[model samples]
Target: MIFVRLCLNTIVRRWNSTELTKVQMPAIMHLTRLGYTYAVKFHDNQAGEDYVPDTNILIKIFKEQFERLNPDKKDTFNQVLKDIKMELDNDDLGRSFYNRLVSVSPSRLIDFEHPNNNVFHCTAEFTCKRDEDEFRPDITLFVNGLPLTFIEVKKPNNNGGMLAESNRMNNQRFPNKKFRRFINITQLMIFSNNMEYDSEGGIIPIQGVFYCTGSKSKSSFNCFREENKGGEKVAPYNAEYSYKSIDSLVEKRVLTDFNC
Candidate 1:
């Protein structure tokens, strides 16, 4: 009787073990496939043909632009920028962004991965199968294990080009349910025309986009939330604001919030 009981216990343990393996093995395999692609594209000795833009270059531009701005305009500009940034940093955005990039929690990911995991040597672009179609984002932001953000950048002089790109990005067909299932884990969707900044559903045109410059002045940042038609809110479609304000929003972890 004791032997029979022991055998039953062993079977139960094995069943539980199998269940756990079933859940974790697929993710491990999927991540491994992603890793393989990452390794091939980012080999150390690649030359000019393999180069990608340095994100730090963009950051440097923001810093330099801010420094170059006139001092009298800095205060108001800084305040508005700071407020918008704080709004973006709220918990919802941060968690969604972190989850999308890290695969696991950001803290644990950092603990297990190398410090430079999030920094890629080059931009790795690929087309993955989405439903029955193929879809690709212009750039994928990677850390060590997973993609953090999908960025679509447009040249500053590309008249109406940015808008076109934005439309493509927000298209449901691009991030089909399957792709969304894979990338929904990501944090933010960034659309920049090298001139304007915008995000999902805050205000349109006026409130939706901002001009990003580094100048320090109230004029550097403008809100499109003002009333235009007899106290009715006017939506400024493509007005520009300082890029500094946009950078502050990103740096301060404003886009971290997922809540609308």
Candidate 2:
């Protein structure tokens, strides 16, 4: 747990699945502490109180980040915001949104290692509501106040696998408008459970959906059972596939941003 804390200092505290917090999410309060957009959370003209980004703050982050990457493209600001809003409302998976942001210039939109050249913002357990279907997830990772990833945590190996559900929820929900607007700029949709040991026969994978904690994932054993092997057979964890998806998006973001 300490390793997790060291690796990811998310704004929210440790989450309890059984005891879901009906109260306000901690991220809403600590966005500034965790380095939110411009080191400031959103506020409105009517009332000067900390709140999530409204349309203006969202557009401001886009403008500031865009200017940082492509200073020559100020003419595209209004149209870009219009396009971004349309993309956010229309595209459920945020593929188009990701492309629009990174395709403008060749610069890092999110850099943890670079203090000055960073636009990425990460928060957890923030409330996102669309029409009718209001579901609160465990975590939401953001870049420049634009969400980039949605992570759902469950008990150790709560179900059989996550690849199926991740696909279903993220890819197939386009037909249902109610669920589409909740996620924005999402490059990765991760479903992970705690480390679960196979009581009958031990398996190498006993942790989250990702194999490694810091931007790497690999599995030693295969998921399938070999006839010759005496012990229970295991197929390769699906982490490789997930990693490839994330990597492809990142690569595209870079190439498009650089105009290469």
Per-residue CA lDDT of model 1 for 1-260, tens digit only, reads 99999999888766534432332222223333343122223322432233212111122222223333323444443453343234333434244434423443212322234443333311323343433655554455444333445554444444554445444444553334444333333444554444333533545442232322111111122323443445333334313322122233332221122111
lDDT of 2 by residue, 164-236 (tens): 4443454444345554544444456555554433433444443445421111122122232234433434433
| Reference-based lDDT, residue 200, model 2 | 39
TM-scores, all candidates, are: 0.34, 0.48
Residue 11's lDDT within candidate 1 is 86
Worst window of 10 by summed lDDT in candidate 2? 211-220
* Cα lDDT, all candidates: 0.36, 0.45
Off by over 4 Å in 2: 1-60, 89-95, 105-116, 157-175, 196-207, 210-260
